[model samples]
Target: MNIPGELYFTKEHEWVRIEGDTGIVGITDYAQHSLGDVTFVELPKIGADVKQFQSLATIESVKAASDIFSPVSGKVAEANKKIEDDPALVNRSCYSEGWIAKIKMCEPSEKNNLMDAAAYKKFVERLEH
Candidate 1:
Protein backbone atom coordinates (compact mmCIF):
# COMPACT_ATOMS: atom_id res chain seq x y z
CA MET A 1 0.00 0.00 0.00
CA ASN A 2 1.06 3.61 -0.55
CA ILE A 3 1.35 4.89 3.01
CA PRO A 4 2.96 8.28 2.85
CA GLY A 5 5.27 9.01 5.78
CA GLU A 6 4.09 12.59 6.34
CA LEU A 7 0.45 11.63 6.96
CA TYR A 8 -1.25 10.41 10.11
CA PHE A 9 -3.42 7.26 10.02
CA THR A 10 -6.35 5.82 11.90
CA LYS A 11 -7.09 2.17 12.66
CA GLU A 12 -10.20 2.56 10.48
CA HIS A 13 -8.00 3.24 7.44
CA GLU A 14 -8.37 6.97 7.00
CA TRP A 15 -5.48 9.43 6.70
CA VAL A 16 -5.01 13.06 7.65
CA ARG A 17 -2.53 15.48 6.15
CA ILE A 18 -2.28 18.46 8.42
CA GLU A 19 -1.65 21.87 6.91
CA GLY A 20 -1.59 24.55 9.59
CA ASP A 21 -4.93 24.12 11.41
CA THR A 22 -6.66 22.45 8.48
CA GLY A 23 -6.66 18.68 8.05
CA ILE A 24 -7.01 17.11 4.65
CA VAL A 25 -8.73 13.76 5.11
CA GLY A 26 -9.17 10.70 2.96
CA ILE A 27 -9.46 6.92 2.91
CA THR A 28 -6.05 5.25 2.85
CA ASP A 29 -4.65 3.49 -0.21
CA TYR A 30 -5.24 0.19 1.56
CA ALA A 31 -8.89 1.16 2.01
CA GLN A 32 -9.44 1.99 -1.66
CA HIS A 33 -7.67 -1.19 -2.74
CA SER A 34 -9.92 -3.32 -0.57
CA LEU A 35 -13.06 -1.48 -1.67
CA GLY A 36 -12.33 -2.00 -5.37
CA ASP A 37 -13.77 0.28 -8.03
CA VAL A 38 -15.49 3.18 -6.26
CA THR A 39 -18.92 4.07 -7.62
CA PHE A 40 -20.13 6.83 -5.32
CA VAL A 41 -19.05 9.14 -2.52
CA GLU A 42 -21.33 10.92 -0.04
CA LEU A 43 -19.41 13.80 1.47
CA PRO A 44 -20.22 15.87 4.53
CA LYS A 45 -21.74 19.31 4.00
CA ILE A 46 -19.58 22.40 4.36
CA GLY A 47 -19.63 23.87 7.87
CA ALA A 48 -20.87 20.57 9.32
CA ASP A 49 -19.32 19.72 12.68
CA VAL A 50 -17.64 16.32 12.91
CA LYS A 51 -16.06 14.36 15.71
CA GLN A 52 -12.81 12.50 15.73
CA PHE A 53 -13.13 8.85 14.68
CA GLN A 54 -16.76 9.53 13.65
CA SER A 55 -18.26 8.92 10.24
CA LEU A 56 -17.47 11.83 7.97
CA ALA A 57 -18.41 10.40 4.58
CA THR A 58 -19.64 7.22 2.93
CA ILE A 59 -18.03 5.59 -0.06
CA GLU A 60 -19.61 2.93 -2.23
CA SER A 61 -17.56 0.57 -4.31
CA VAL A 62 -18.27 -2.46 -6.47
CA LYS A 63 -17.24 -4.68 -3.56
CA ALA A 64 -18.74 -2.85 -0.61
CA ALA A 65 -19.86 0.38 0.99
CA SER A 66 -17.70 1.85 3.74
CA ASP A 67 -17.72 4.87 6.04
CA ILE A 68 -14.81 7.26 5.92
CA PHE A 69 -14.05 8.35 9.48
CA SER A 70 -12.49 11.60 10.56
CA PRO A 71 -9.07 11.29 12.16
CA VAL A 72 -9.59 14.64 13.85
CA SER A 73 -12.62 16.64 15.02
CA GLY A 74 -13.47 19.79 13.08
CA LYS A 75 -15.88 21.71 10.89
CA VAL A 76 -16.06 20.58 7.30
CA ALA A 77 -14.36 23.32 5.35
CA GLU A 78 -14.39 21.72 1.89
CA ALA A 79 -15.37 18.52 0.17
CA ASN A 80 -13.68 17.30 -2.99
CA LYS A 81 -16.29 17.55 -5.75
CA LYS A 82 -13.89 15.84 -8.12
CA ILE A 83 -14.45 12.51 -6.36
CA GLU A 84 -18.23 13.02 -6.66
CA ASP A 85 -17.93 13.31 -10.43
CA ASP A 86 -15.33 10.55 -10.93
CA PRO A 87 -15.36 8.24 -8.01
CA ALA A 88 -12.77 6.08 -9.70
CA LEU A 89 -10.22 8.73 -8.82
CA VAL A 90 -10.22 7.14 -5.39
CA ASN A 91 -8.91 3.90 -6.84
CA ARG A 92 -6.50 5.76 -9.08
CA SER A 93 -4.91 8.19 -6.61
CA CYS A 94 -6.34 7.98 -3.10
CA TYR A 95 -3.64 10.02 -1.40
CA SER A 96 -3.81 13.06 -3.67
CA GLU A 97 -6.73 13.71 -6.02
CA GLY A 98 -9.02 11.41 -4.03
CA TRP A 99 -8.83 13.32 -0.72
CA ILE A 100 -12.41 13.44 0.62
CA ALA A 101 -12.56 16.57 2.76
CA LYS A 102 -10.72 19.45 4.33
CA ILE A 103 -11.53 20.13 7.96
CA LYS A 104 -10.86 23.28 9.97
CA MET A 105 -9.59 21.53 13.11
CA CYS A 106 -11.43 22.06 16.36
CA GLU A 107 -8.76 20.37 18.46
CA PRO A 108 -5.33 19.88 17.00
CA SER A 109 -4.36 17.80 20.02
CA GLU A 110 -6.57 15.03 18.64
CA LYS A 111 -3.75 14.31 16.22
CA ASN A 112 -1.78 12.74 19.05
CA ASN A 113 -4.31 9.89 19.03
CA LEU A 114 -3.39 8.90 15.46
CA MET A 115 -0.63 6.57 14.23
CA ASP A 116 2.42 7.40 12.22
CA ALA A 117 3.04 5.80 8.80
CA ALA A 118 5.25 3.06 10.26
CA ALA A 119 2.65 2.05 12.78
CA TYR A 120 -0.06 2.09 10.14
CA LYS A 121 2.04 -0.11 7.86
CA LYS A 122 2.30 -2.64 10.65
CA PHE A 123 -1.43 -2.34 11.25
CA VAL A 124 -2.17 -3.08 7.59
CA GLU A 125 0.19 -6.04 7.71
CA ARG A 126 -1.67 -7.46 10.67
CA LEU A 127 -4.96 -7.02 8.82
CA GLU A 128 -3.63 -8.99 5.87
CA HIS A 129 -2.79 -11.89 8.12
Candidate 2:
Protein backbone atom coordinates (compact mmCIF):
# COMPACT_ATOMS: atom_id res chain seq x y z
CA MET A 1 0.00 0.00 0.00
CA ASN A 2 1.14 3.59 -0.60
CA ILE A 3 1.65 5.20 2.75
CA PRO A 4 3.11 8.65 2.13
CA GLY A 5 5.80 9.52 4.64
CA GLU A 6 4.54 13.04 5.27
CA LEU A 7 1.11 12.07 6.59
CA TYR A 8 -0.20 10.93 9.96
CA PHE A 9 -2.45 7.87 10.45
CA THR A 10 -5.12 6.35 12.66
CA LYS A 11 -5.63 2.69 13.50
CA GLU A 12 -9.05 3.08 11.88
CA HIS A 13 -7.23 3.30 8.52
CA GLU A 14 -7.52 7.04 7.93
CA TRP A 15 -4.72 9.49 7.09
CA VAL A 16 -4.25 13.20 7.54
CA ARG A 17 -1.92 15.50 5.68
CA ILE A 18 -1.05 18.47 7.83
CA GLU A 19 -0.77 21.79 6.04
CA GLY A 20 -0.30 24.88 8.21
CA ASP A 21 -3.15 24.74 10.75
CA THR A 22 -5.35 22.69 8.42
CA GLY A 23 -5.43 18.94 8.06
CA ILE A 24 -6.52 17.20 4.89
CA VAL A 25 -8.03 13.84 5.75
CA GLY A 26 -8.80 10.60 3.90
CA ILE A 27 -8.69 6.83 4.04
CA THR A 28 -5.38 5.11 3.31
CA ASP A 29 -4.57 3.00 0.25
CA TYR A 30 -4.84 -0.12 2.36
CA ALA A 31 -8.31 0.92 3.38
CA GLN A 32 -9.55 1.44 -0.18
CA HIS A 33 -8.09 -1.87 -1.26
CA SER A 34 -9.80 -3.66 1.58
CA LEU A 35 -13.11 -2.03 0.76
CA GLY A 36 -13.02 -2.96 -2.92
CA ASP A 37 -14.62 -0.55 -5.39
CA VAL A 38 -16.08 2.50 -3.65
CA THR A 39 -19.64 3.42 -4.58
CA PHE A 40 -20.36 6.43 -2.36
CA VAL A 41 -18.95 8.77 0.25
CA GLU A 42 -20.92 10.79 2.79
CA LEU A 43 -18.73 13.85 2.87
CA PRO A 44 -18.56 15.86 6.03
CA LYS A 45 -20.40 19.16 6.05
CA ILE A 46 -18.42 22.35 5.77
CA GLY A 47 -18.24 24.39 9.00
CA ALA A 48 -19.04 21.30 11.09
CA ASP A 49 -17.11 20.85 14.32
CA VAL A 50 -15.49 17.40 14.55
CA LYS A 51 -13.61 15.90 17.45
CA GLN A 52 -10.55 13.70 17.27
CA PHE A 53 -11.26 10.07 16.39
CA GLN A 54 -14.92 10.85 15.82
CA SER A 55 -16.96 9.78 12.82
CA LEU A 56 -16.03 12.34 10.22
CA ALA A 57 -17.50 10.55 7.21
CA THR A 58 -18.95 7.31 5.90
CA ILE A 59 -17.85 5.39 2.83
CA GLU A 60 -19.73 2.69 0.98
CA SER A 61 -17.91 0.14 -1.10
CA VAL A 62 -18.66 -2.99 -3.04
CA LYS A 63 -17.69 -4.97 0.04
CA ALA A 64 -18.97 -2.90 2.93
CA ALA A 65 -19.68 0.50 4.44
CA SER A 66 -17.50 1.95 7.16
CA ASP A 67 -17.13 5.04 9.29
CA ILE A 68 -14.03 7.10 8.65
CA PHE A 69 -12.62 8.70 11.76
CA SER A 70 -10.88 12.03 12.07
CA PRO A 71 -7.20 12.09 12.98
CA VAL A 72 -7.50 15.39 14.78
CA SER A 73 -10.11 17.76 16.20
CA GLY A 74 -11.25 20.72 14.12
CA LYS A 75 -13.98 22.43 12.13
CA VAL A 76 -14.55 21.14 8.64
CA ALA A 77 -13.19 23.87 6.44
CA GLU A 78 -13.93 22.10 3.18
CA ALA A 79 -15.47 18.88 1.91
CA ASN A 80 -14.46 17.16 -1.32
CA LYS A 81 -17.77 17.37 -3.12
CA LYS A 82 -16.10 15.92 -6.17
CA ILE A 83 -16.11 12.60 -4.35
CA GLU A 84 -19.82 12.93 -3.87
CA ASP A 85 -20.28 12.87 -7.62
CA ASP A 86 -17.54 10.41 -8.53
CA PRO A 87 -16.72 8.09 -5.69
CA ALA A 88 -14.29 6.13 -7.85
CA LEU A 89 -11.80 8.95 -7.35
CA VAL A 90 -11.27 7.53 -3.88
CA ASN A 91 -10.20 4.19 -5.37
CA ARG A 92 -8.11 5.84 -8.07
CA SER A 93 -6.21 8.42 -5.98
CA CYS A 94 -6.79 8.06 -2.29
CA TYR A 95 -3.91 10.29 -1.28
CA SER A 96 -4.48 13.34 -3.44
CA GLU A 97 -7.71 14.28 -5.23
CA GLY A 98 -9.47 11.77 -3.00
CA TRP A 99 -8.91 13.53 0.30
CA ILE A 100 -12.19 13.78 2.26
CA ALA A 101 -12.04 17.05 4.15
CA LYS A 102 -9.78 19.90 5.22
CA ILE A 103 -10.17 20.71 8.89
CA LYS A 104 -9.25 23.97 10.60
CA MET A 105 -7.47 22.41 13.55
CA CYS A 106 -8.65 23.16 17.08
CA GLU A 107 -5.69 21.31 18.60
CA PRO A 108 -2.70 20.84 16.40
CA SER A 109 -1.16 18.91 19.24
CA GLU A 110 -3.79 16.20 18.68
CA LYS A 111 -1.64 15.05 15.79
CA ASN A 112 0.58 13.42 18.39
CA ASN A 113 -2.15 10.83 18.95
CA LEU A 114 -1.71 9.58 15.39
CA MET A 115 0.98 7.38 13.90
CA ASP A 116 3.69 8.44 11.46
CA ALA A 117 3.89 6.69 8.10
CA ALA A 118 6.65 4.33 9.17
CA ALA A 119 4.76 3.37 12.30
CA TYR A 120 1.55 2.95 10.33
CA LYS A 121 3.49 0.94 7.76
CA LYS A 122 4.50 -1.42 10.52
CA PHE A 123 0.98 -1.43 11.84
CA VAL A 124 -0.51 -2.53 8.53
CA GLU A 125 2.18 -5.16 8.17
CA ARG A 126 1.22 -6.57 11.52
CA LEU A 127 -2.34 -6.81 10.31
CA GLU A 128 -1.29 -8.79 7.24
CA HIS A 129 0.16 -11.52 9.44
Each candidate structure's TM-score, on Cα atoms with residue i matched to residue i, is 0.98, 0.98
Worst 10 residues of 1 by lDDT: 61-70
What lDDT tens digits, residue by residue, belong to model 2 across residues 1-129?
Answer: 799999999999999999999999999999999999999999888999999999999999987889999999989999999999999999999999999999999898898899999999999999999
lDDT of each: 0.95, 0.95
Residue 113's lDDT within candidate 2 is 96
Error at 118, model 2, angstroms: 0.7
* TM-score for candidate 1: 0.98
What value does the lDDT take at residue 122 in candidate 1? 98
In model 1, which runs have C-alpha deviations exceeding 4 angstroms?
A: none
